[model samples]
Target chain A: MTQPTYDSLKVGDEIPTLTTPSVSRHTLALYCGASGDHNPIHVDLDFAKKSGLDDVIAHGMLSAGYLAQMLTNWVPQSALRSFNNRFTAMTQIGDTVSCSGKIVEKFEKDDEKFVRLELYSNTPQAQTIVAEAVLVLA
Target chain B: MIDKKHIGYNFPPVTIPVEEGRLKFLAKSLGETKAIYTDPDAAKAAGYPGLLAPPTFPFMLEIDALDLVDFMSVLGETLEKLLHGEENFNYYAPIYAGDSITVRKRITDIIDKKGGALQFVISDNTFTNQHGKIVAETRTNYVFRHQ
Candidate 1:
C-alpha cells in the first residue's frame, strides 16, 4: 500500500479506516508473552470474573496496537513522532476493533513538518479508546 | 483508600536491552508486516539505526519492569480490582534495537471518584537511552474498584 506523503496531506483529511480481525483468547495469550503483561484479568477467566468482569479481557495495549497499526500502515514508521491513548473501556475476546484517524493540525516546528491527528478505536457497540498523536513527515 | 502520600513516589530504575528478535516477535503478534520492524536492512533503508521497535513495543519493557503487585500494595490496593484506564506515550526520539534504555517510574496522581467506589492511580515513566538521551515518556492510569 502506498502511504500518503506529507505534502499530500491537509488538515481535516481523514486517514483510511481499518477494522481488525476479531480478537481471540489465543491472540491475547500471545500478546501476554510478547508484551510481558500477565495481568490475570487479561488471561484468567476465573480471575476476571472475580474481578467483576464477565470474561477475560484483551490488553489495552492490544487495542492500542491496532491504532498504531492504522497509522503505520498509512504513514512511514520513521514519521511517527508521538502516540497516546485513553483506554476508556474494556475489550473482550471476540470483539472486532476498528480504528480511524483524522489530521487535525499541521505545522512546522524546529524546521520539521508535522501533522497532528485525533485517533480512535471502537468495538461495534461503542468507542473504547480515544487518542491523539503527532507524526513527522519527510 | 489509596495513599495520597505515595503520589510522589519513584521506583527503582530498570535498564532493558532491546533485541531484534523480540521486536520481530512483537511485530508478528500484532500481525504487522512492516519490513522495518522485522528486518535491520529495511530499517536502515528507512533511516533507522537498526530494526525499529514498533510504536507500542515499549510496553514489553515497561510492563516487565513494573511490579504491579508491589506497586498496588504500596498504595493499599489489590490487584483483582484493577483495570487499565489510560496510557499515553510521548516520543522525543526513536527507540532502536540494541539500545539499552533505562525506565524510571513514579506515581504522579491519585484520585477518588464516585464516592470512593473507584480510585485512579496515575504514573509517569521516563525512558533514557544508553547515552543518557531522553527517548520517551509514558503516562499510565490504572482504575481500581472498591469491593
Candidate 2:
C-alpha cells in the first residue's frame, strides 16, 4: 500500500494492526549499532543474568520500535512527526510485540491539519499505553 | 520545590548525518522488513521518493547532529545504573532516508517518584532537518536508580 498523504484522513481514525517478530540476537546487535545504546542487558547473556534476568533481553526502545513500524504504515511515511511508547514489561528474547493507535482529537493549527493520537503496544505479558502524540500536516 | 528559573535551560545542539547504512542497521535490529526502511525500490512502491526511515529511526543520533552533546551527557547519570523508563515522540512529518537532522536537548522535568520504581528525569529534544525544517519533537524519560 502507498503511504497516505495529508488529506484522506479524518478524526477518530484507528491505525491498522502491526506485529513485531520475536527477539533475536542478531537483531539486538543491529539495534545497538543503530541506537548507540549498547546496554549489555540487551545483548549479553552473562550481563543479563548478572542483572537478574532469565536471559538476554530485548532493548526497551526496540520493543517500542514495533509501534513505530505500525505508525509508519498507518500514517504517511515521515508524515509521522513523532512516535513514542512506554516499556511496561520485559520483552524476552522470544516474545512478540504488537501495536495499534487511535486518533484522540483533531484540530486546525496555523492552517495545518493536526491530529492527536493515542498509541498502544501489547506484549504477551502485558498491554502498555505507550504515549500521546500530535501530528501536523500541510 | 521545582524552579522555573531554569525552565529554559538549553543543552548545546549536535549535528549528525543521516546515512543509509544507519537506517538499515536500525531496521535490521528491530527485525523490520518494510521495503521503505531497507529497499529504495520498495519505498518507491510505497509511493515514497526513495527508501525512508522507520518511524523511530530519528530517536538515534540523527537528532543530535548539531553539537548537542549535553543531551547525551546527563551530569548525574551512571551508565551502570541508567535505565530508560519511557519514550514519547510527537511527529510533524515523516523522516526518511537521506534526510539530515539536528537535535537540541533540554531538561523538561525532574521529579523524585518517592523511591518508586524509578525517579524520573525528562528531556525534550527538537529535531530539524538539513533544510532547517522542524521535523519532529521527542520527549524521553530516564529512570535513574533511586537512592
lDDT scores of the candidates, listed in order: 0.85, 0.68
lDDT of 1 at B38: 81
Best by TM-score: 1
lDDT tens digits by residue: candidate 1, A46-112: 9988888889988989989989988888876668878888888778789999999999999999989
Which regions of candidate 2 fall more than 4 Å away from where they truly are?
A2-14, A106-115, A135-138, B1-9, B41-50, B62-74, B115-117
TM-score of chain B of 2: 0.80
- TM-score of the A chain in candidate 1? 0.94
- Alpha-carbon RMSD of each model: 1.8, 4.3
Give the candidate number with the greatest DockQ. 1
Expressed as tens digits, the lDDT of each residue in B1-147 for candidate 2 is 233344456777776667777777777777678777888778788787656766665567533342123333534344434567777766666666777677787777776676554566677888888888877777777666544
lDDT tens per residue, model 2, A1-138: 765444766767787888877767877888877777766777888877666667886777776777766666665554555556776666667777777788887778677776778877777887754666666656
Taking all chains together, each candidate's TM-score versus the true structure is 0.93, 0.78
Clashing residue pairs in candidate 1 are none
